[model samples]
Each structure stands twice: as structure tokens, then as C-alpha cells.
Target: MTSPTIVTAAMLAIGDELLSGRTKDKNIGHLADMLTMVGIDLREVRIVADDQDAIVEALNALRSRYRHVFTSGGIGPTHDDITADAISKAFGVECIHEPKAMELLAAMYERRGMEFTEARKRMARMPEGATHIPNPVSTAPGFAIENVYVMAGVPQVFQAMLDALLPSLETGTPVLSRTVRSPYGEGDIGAPLTEVQKNHPETSIGSYPRFDGKSFSTDIVIRARDATVLGAAETEVIAMIEAIGRSREKHQP
Candidate 1:
């Protein structure tokens, strides 16, 4: 039998405001959920300030290691918006005023009775040979060059760009997950959980603990690309939980 194809990606969030905690990041989680649905595993995420050198370094590193690199923020019309330039530097290409981008932004501004100012025209700049990623919410579009996708900082615009971008990209078999909740602490099932993981090497097992004011509980999630493997892993996890519960019951007075 042929092995399942695994598509992996990394994320780079660029902005000084993000690092300063002035603006909360919402794109990372949105991208994670959306990428999973399309069978692209988000393996790593990095946040860098709006510095050209920093963006270039992080972009190079991420694009080299992952199959795809999705970047958000810094692709705007302000001085700090240097994502496009940094991407150009990383790929050793020239940044230019892409004709399609200019046409779209010019028309939008004209329709709105707004002057196409130099700062606003900055949105038309893109790395050479990059394809536009449509921005439904705004006239300023994002771009995809090679494996890296440069998107907007705004949440609505980022999501809209992603919606437009996903269809054109290749996808693999989606990953499936099963959750088993138990009213026992993670500490109580640590050893058994490890054993279960060893038994099911194909599935990834994770234990998340939750506290509800008075009681502690855990949620065990098993994820795999194959349905049968996921089901078998879930069954073993349930059996481990039951055995632990029974052992505690027998020892209690």
C-alpha cells in the first residue's frame, strides 16, 4: 500500500505591534484551523517585528524548512509595512509596482473619490514574479511568490485572502481526530497514556488538562490521517482510562 502524503506548512506573523502586545494576533489560530481542514499541517509559527532584516531571516528559514510558508502582517501602505521588500530581498528579486495591483488600487481610489497618494500606492509594490492573492475586503491584494504567501495584517482581509488563495494550492488527505474525555487528572493517567502512545505510533496523542473550580479532568485527543488508525488509538485510550478508574475504585474504602 502507498503511504499517505503529508503536506506541512509554517507561519510567519510580522509586526512590531504584535511583539509589543498592542495588537492581539487572531490570524495564527484561523490559519491553523483552515490549513488543517485542507490537509496542510502547520508545523511551526514565528512572529517577527517589522524589521527588514528580521523578516528576511525568518522568511528564508521558514520557506526552506516547510513545504509552504504563510505570512500575515506588514504588507500594508505604511512605513513599517516592509514585508514585500523583505520577501524580495530574501528571494534575491527586485520589488516593483505590479501592474495589476496598481490598476486595482487606482480604480478603487478613484471610485471612492480618494487621491492615489504615494503612501497608498505603496500597496501596489510586490516582489517580482509574484502572483496576486485577491483581497475581497479591500482593493489592496496580497501576493504569492514561490512557496511563501504574503497576506494582510487585518483579520477580515487575511481571511478573505486565504479563501481566495486556498483553491489554487494542492492539498492532501485530511487528518482526523477523536477526543476522549475523562474525569481524572492527567497525572493519574500519565504512565498508561505513554504506553498507549507507544502502542499506536501512527497516531499522535495529546492530553490537555482542565480545571472546573473544584475538579480536575483531562481530554485526550488522538489524531491520524487514517480513520482505522484513529479509531484504534481512541479505543486503546478509553481502555486505559477505564482500567485506571477500576484500579482506583478497588483501592478505595
Candidate 2:
């Protein structure tokens, strides 16, 4: 049997606010969901401060390891928004103000009756040989250099940029998943579930515990690249739950 094609990706979320309690990150989850829909498995995510060295180091590691690397935050016009510079350093290139990006931002600012100040011009800066990722929400575009896509920190803008950029990327087969809910807790099914997982190597079985104030139960999620394998594993999980139920009933006097 032929193995399924799997395209993997990693995410770098850059900003001091993210590390601090100032700003909550919403872009990471959005990116993960969107990438999964397009068949790009987001395998890892790292959050770093606005430090240039940290961003460069994380970017280098992720870009080398995955098919794609997505970065959010630290690409704005402010002095601390240093993602562009970090990316340039990572690729050993100079971050310059691209003429096309400058033009786009200038026009948008002109229409908004705002001055395109030196600070605003900083938004046009990108790594050498980088392509612009269009930002429909804001005219200040994100950038793509090689495998890394640097996007905005704002959730709305990040999502818009990703939506525009996703069509150009190659995708693999989307993974399928099935969930089986059991009234039993993890303690009740842990041993058997481990056996089920070992028996079916092709499927990934994850057990999540849920609480409803009164009691705790388990939500077993089975994921696989093939539908047949996924369904087979799901069936085994359900059977295991049923057997546990029967055992509980047998013990009741």
C-alpha cells in the first residue's frame, strides 16, 4: 500500500505582548485550523519575544525542519516590530523597502487622508527576494521568502493574509478524524485504549477528559489519513467503551 503524502508546517508567533499577559494570541489557533483544512499539518508552534535573535533562531530551526514556516506578529510599522529584519538576517539578506509594497501602502494612506510617514514606510520593508502576501484588510502587506510566511499580529489581518496566500501553496491529503464519547473516565479506559492504539498503528488516538461539574468523561478522537483506517479504529474504540460499560454493569449488585 502506498503511504499518504503529508505536508508539515511550523508556526512562530513573535511579540513581547504574547509572552507577556498584555495580548492574547488568536492567530495561532486560526492558522492551525486553516492549515489543517488545506491539508498542511501544523506540527509545532513557538512563541518568542520581540528580540531579533530569538526570532531568527526559531525561524531558522522551523524553516529547515518543515515544508512551510508561518510567523505572526512583529511585522508592523513600529520600531519594536522587527520580524522583517529577523527574517532578513535568517536568510542572510538585507531587509529593504520594496518599491511595490511602498506604492501600495502609499496609495492606501493617501486615500485615507493620512501621511505616509517614515514610521509607516517601515511597513514596506521586507527581505531581499521576498514576495508580498496581499493584505485585503490593511494595505500594509505581509511577506513570503522561501518557505517562511511572515504575517501581521492582528487576528483579522493575519487571517486575511493567510486566506490570500493559501491558494498559492501546494496541499496534501486532508486528515480524517472521528470522535467517540464515553461516560467512562480515562482511568476506566486507559489500559484498553493503550492496547487499541498499539493494535492500530496507522491511526492516532487521543483521549481528552471532559468535566460537567457533576462527573468526568472521556472524548476519544481517532485521526488517520485513510477513511478505512479511521473508521476501523473508531469502531474498536466504541467496542472498548461498550465492553467497559458491560463490565461496570456486571459489577453492580
For 1-253, candidate 1 gives per-residue lDDT tens digits of: 2588888899999999999999999999999999999999899999999999999999999999999999999888989889999999999999999999999999999999999999999999999999999998997999999999999989999999999999888777889999999889988988889999999999999999999999889999999999999989998998988898899899999
Please report, in order, the local distance difference test score of every candidate based on alpha carbons.
Answer: 0.93, 0.93
Off by over 4 Å in 1: 213-215
Model 2: how far residue 149 lies from native, Å:
0.2
Clash pairs for candidate 2? none
The residue-level lDDT of candidate 2 at 207 comes to: 96
C-alpha root-mean-square deviation, each candidate:
1.2, 1.1
lDDT of 1: 0.93
- Per-residue accuracy of model 2 over 87-144 as CA lDDT, tens digit each: 9999999999999999999999999999999999999999989999999998899999
- Stretches of candidate 2 above 4 Å error? none
Error of 1 at 51 (Å): 0.5
- Displacement of residue 238 (Cα, Å) in model 1 is 1.3
